[model samples]
Target chain A: MIIMVAIDPSYLITQVLNGLVWGLVLALIAMGLALIYGLLDIVNFAHGAFYAFGAYVAWQTLLSGGNYWVALLTVPLAMILLGLFVESTLLRRLYGQDTKFTLIFNFGLMLVIVQTCRFIWGARGKPISIPSELAFSVNLGILSYPAYRLFVIALTSAIAIAVFVFLRKTHVGMATRAGIQNREMVQVLGVNIGRIYTLIYTIGICIAGIAGLVASPLFGVYPEMGAEVLIPAFVVVVVGGMGSFHGSILAGILVGQVATLPIIWEPRIAQVMIYIFMAIVLLARPAGLFGELGR
Target chain B: MLEVRDIHTFYGDSHILFGVSLEIKEQEVVALLGRNGVGKTTTLRSIMGLTPPKKGTVLMNGEDITHEPIHRRAKIGIGYVPEDRGIFPGLTVHENLTIAADGVGAPGGNYEDAFKFFPELGKYLPSRAGRLSGGEQQMLAVARALVGTKHVLILDEPTQGLAPKVVDRITHAIKGISKKTSILMVEQNTDLALRLADRVYIMRDGNIVFSGVPQQVRDNEEVQSYLVIS
Candidate 1:
């Protein structure tokens, strides 16, 4: 019994690392949702479509005999340009309207995007091999960790840092924050709020794209790739609270812990654990842990 | 050097400003006076093209600007500071000021003149607009409106919630502008507005009820009790 329980925590610790990696993936997707829904008050349901692009682009790069690192860099830039295109053309049209329109319409757009992906890539999962260099696990005294997973952790942490810094220290970030408070007031102050809105949308979607690209090597790419990451991202966004960056991070990790660590006990119900926490969090705080009260 | 002629504007389906019109020349300060919900703000919005006037023309120096966009109007020396004290709360005081001037057509920007009016803004240049006190934000709103190049400055309300002492400072600042620019201000404080205005127009229910020199409109207690307050 002691041996079974002893392997339990080690198994759990390993799962904890898995959960961190998973949470980072969700956090990237959440960054986009947080920017558009949290800050702009526009629920960009089409975000998963962007995530789909990140996975497929990375998939194409791998199939084309290209380096994974080049694919990593190129995919995000492609997503940024894609974000810019969607913003300047379609998203700009929907802004300031009742948000019910965005929710329903973007869902429709999401359907179109998914169908497009299905048409192109077919309805099958494709496994991606880790770059040969990252296949080894690093053994710390207490735990043995996969180096590729560690790379994922490091990359996600770095992206999270960069995101926090951008939102806290940059001009566009400040404008997004103010625009979130009162859009009309910001516009009247002589700032081109239209331009600011576009930038936020681009940045938000690109983050999701990066999340997709990074996850491709680990989970591989599939037509339903968005479905795998999106549910957790929504939960992360909610558990993280609307527009609260740090809240998203903490909540993401916590949700991740509940999902992966608990899976060691009952594999069938591992994913269900996240919903349980989200339900509890909603009942108790509604804003999730670290969520602001008055927002 | 501003002329608003027979402008019509709407809010949804409601016709707010029907043929609203006003004129103010260079170095002159005009007051747009009215009671609540009578479309005073709409008239100003019409001029700035915020609510795109349905029919009418706005001329700055005899040029038709009936369909020109707000920024285009801004480019042609028309600066607007809305009634709401629209401060971009996410920006630092400096960022707020910078965006107003960067890539904007501010000819001979009297940056020094702006500093003279509200030097308090210079101190909190790095602070976000949300962090500043209300009065400082007001100063920032005004400073942004005037920092760039414009010959005509239209302010909806510069002293709405400010203390009397702050109002005095704002009024004094308005009085100090040189002859190169014109000022059009709207205020609820009839006494304070008349004191600063060279010309005043009392608007009632979408039309000009009274228009004259400030002295002529002063102590017109009958107009005050009925139009100004009621």
Candidate 2:
């Protein structure tokens, strides 16, 4: 068939689709990390674990004969409780402590979670077939794309919009933002800053968990899957600028294309693209693209 | 009424406040006069539970609140307008007041009366507090305290950096407020402290060396000399 003969057009389209799909999910994951860092001023090293946990739990729900939509509701709730436990028990102790302790402590938690996941899910990557009702291809003018990719974009964008509005419009949102800017000032205003911190942390992890559940349809469930994207997530966050939501989205898109474009033409060097872009951006603008001045 | 008894406050073992003690009767404007670094602001912070003075009993209307959190102190009718104004820079004047007022319950009894004092606040309710002039910011800070039943109002250096006219305006505003709520004001300007103070305490080295009525403050030549030198 001529389709096999004409690989170039199909290949480029596939790469673009791959980048956009992964980028959307990656942004969701990074947004969670950034929100926690933005408010608490703490690097949540266990965020990748939260993403992995989300995927595993979503997979568990599916294997147990649960509706796919149930994953959306359950994964976030599970991660929220987990986040509350972790923050109240361990993260709370490191509030005024050095960031080095947080990094070390969370990295330890990450190892434990990863090994535990390996113990339960085993070493092999688990296959989670996309729901049959939703399995279809689209003819977008000259190129065909997966319907699942569009769902990934739409669903994640919806989540992001809900989160953005929640943080910007509501009373709790205003209090949380205020607490981020001045926790002591918030306390003076009769707000419970400790409670707000826990709430922000939980919401952040829930976003990551939701990201995992959303991406499970695309990437499948696996233990090492999180490690694969962890570095890139940090790179995207740094590129997007710390604490600025708009910057994170833009950076995620840019980094996504840089990786995919290279992979389309040359598959092996695709992995290096994100790190290269990150280093160049770091050297040029240490604060990231839209990072706050002096940060 | 407010009382501070034997409050020992330390900032990393430097001992900023050394068992300092003071009291203010209801509806009285008590001025705390001291040279810089003599723990005046620290005393205000201790009373506000901002610093949580090490060994002290801060009582508001006979209620023991030495262990009360800062927010609890705020809710329990202690309105603190810090020396810096603490104008929520990103918040508008309206948003600023709303944050202080929008708790789950009704205003703690005297909200309507408090709004009448700062009639100017109603004019610029939509404006950002950070953009307001020094005097206006000071007014907003005071009004914020007033809007939520100020049983004990603490103003730190309300006249510290203001121009002479703004200072006079502030003096009048504070005077107007003194009729409704008890005030514990910390000021370096002796004349402002003296003229406005119902009772004055001259602080030296974190201890009350000279405390008396206005005539006593005016008559103490040594304190007068130190104020000029300070």
Candidate 3:
């Protein structure tokens, strides 16, 4: 019981960096979930399936002789078309109905997507090697870290900032924020809410698609790949406050650390630590860290 | 310029408006007055297509628009200031006006015109709307309507909860606005309605029981009884 052990500072720093990289990826995915829920009021149980589908599509592109850069460029655009089709054909009919209908519908959609992926690609996971330019590690002051992780961090930060500016500055972005608060009033003010909904849903899917493609090299591609991150992403959204953009980013980083940092002392608790953190946060402030009071 | 002809509206299975009919001519202020639960707001909702009349028609410039969507109605130059003010509390005053301006394709130059009515809004353009005082929010609501096309403005109880001082300012704004846009308002304050309106219609049991000029309403004791004015 009194045994003492020395820890390597470099290993600890590496783990922390890993956590940061993972968190940013989670933030990107969770932000999509938050955007769809904020404006459409749909819980979107199928969001994770969309992520898995994106990864598979990227894999297929690579198999057809497309490089990682090409897959990245085209996958999100393809997801936009899929989003347009899904929202207009299926999700459009569910608006104005009970929230339960959409939830159940999305749950069914998720099953369909996952099973379809399994049938097409088989049950085995598919590997996607990192791009040649980013295959090595870069030396930080404390330790060397994979260059791809650094690229992910920089790219995600840029995307987050771009989305923040879009939401705060542009006319359509302002209408979207307004729609989140009061959709009927937005309509009364003469904004076409249906078109706004379509655009938001498309953007949400596109972001999730991008997240999937970006994370594929690290985790490989599989039918159930999205299922692994979906629950944690939900945790990030709830901890950050549902439907809050800034909250998702902050909570994503926090949850990422909680999920990863404990591995040095106890590897068994890594999976459940995020739930514990969420429970403590909920106990302190039931509305979540960034959610509005009484929401 | 706007007419509601024998419109009947229902919420789910329960009927709310029963064959209500009224009209507003070019640049005229028409007040629709009735007691609570008498379907006064429902009549306005029917015209705005918030609750389309199941068995009637609403016409703007002789074109039927009863089935038109709410945003379409607004885009075609029908500005509404709902009973609750309908201010987007999360947005800034400038953003609120911007939405209305964008909705009707109102030019950026019209923002100065809106500010002229309530210069107070210009100072708080950056502040969140929910943080505004009751009087200021009302001014912003009226100012938002003015930023639109000014074809026909529908107001529901714009002064329901404001102070008398605020009421005076709102009254002044409405008086100034009436010269440019046609107004169809449902007001609880009979004296204020009578003062601002060129024409008045009294409703009871979902029907227009009386219609005449403001003086005719004041002189008639029966119309006063329906409004229950002391």
Question: Which CAPRI level is candidate 3?
Answer: medium
Superior by TM-score: candidate 1 or candidate 3: 3
Judged by lDDT against the true structure, how good is candidate 2?
Answer: 0.79
Which ranges in model 2 have alpha carbons more than 4 Å from their true place?
A: A1-17, A93-101, A262-295, B103-117, B123-130, B133-135, B225-230
RMSD, each candidate, Å?
3.5, 4.1, 2.3
Give the winner by TM-score.
3
Name the 10 consecutive residues with the lowest summed lDDT in model 3 chain B: B104-113
Residue-wise C-alpha lDDT for candidate 2, range B35-71, written one tens digit per residue: 7888888898888777888887988889999988677
Compared with the true structure, what per-residue lDDT tens digits does model 3 show for residues B1-230? Answer: 89888998998989888888889998999999988889998888788777789998899999999888788888777888888888889899989989888887763425677887798788899999999999899899888877756789899998999999999999998888888889999999999999999999999988999999999988988778999834
| Runs with alpha carbons beyond 4 Å of true place in candidate 3 | A1-6, A293-295, B107-110
Clashing pairs in 3: none
Better of 1 and 3 by lDDT: 3
Q: Candidate 2 — which pairs collide?
A: none
lDDT of 3 by residue, A1-295 (tens): 1221367789888888889988998998899899898889999889899999899989989989999999988898889999999999999999988999999999999999899989988889999999999999999987899999999889888888888899999888998999988888888877889999999999988888888998999999999888988999999999999898889999999998999988978999998999999999989978788887754
**Most lDDT-accurate candidate:** 3
TM-score of 3: 0.95
Q: Output DockQ, candidate 2.
A: 0.39
TM-score of each: 0.88, 0.88, 0.95
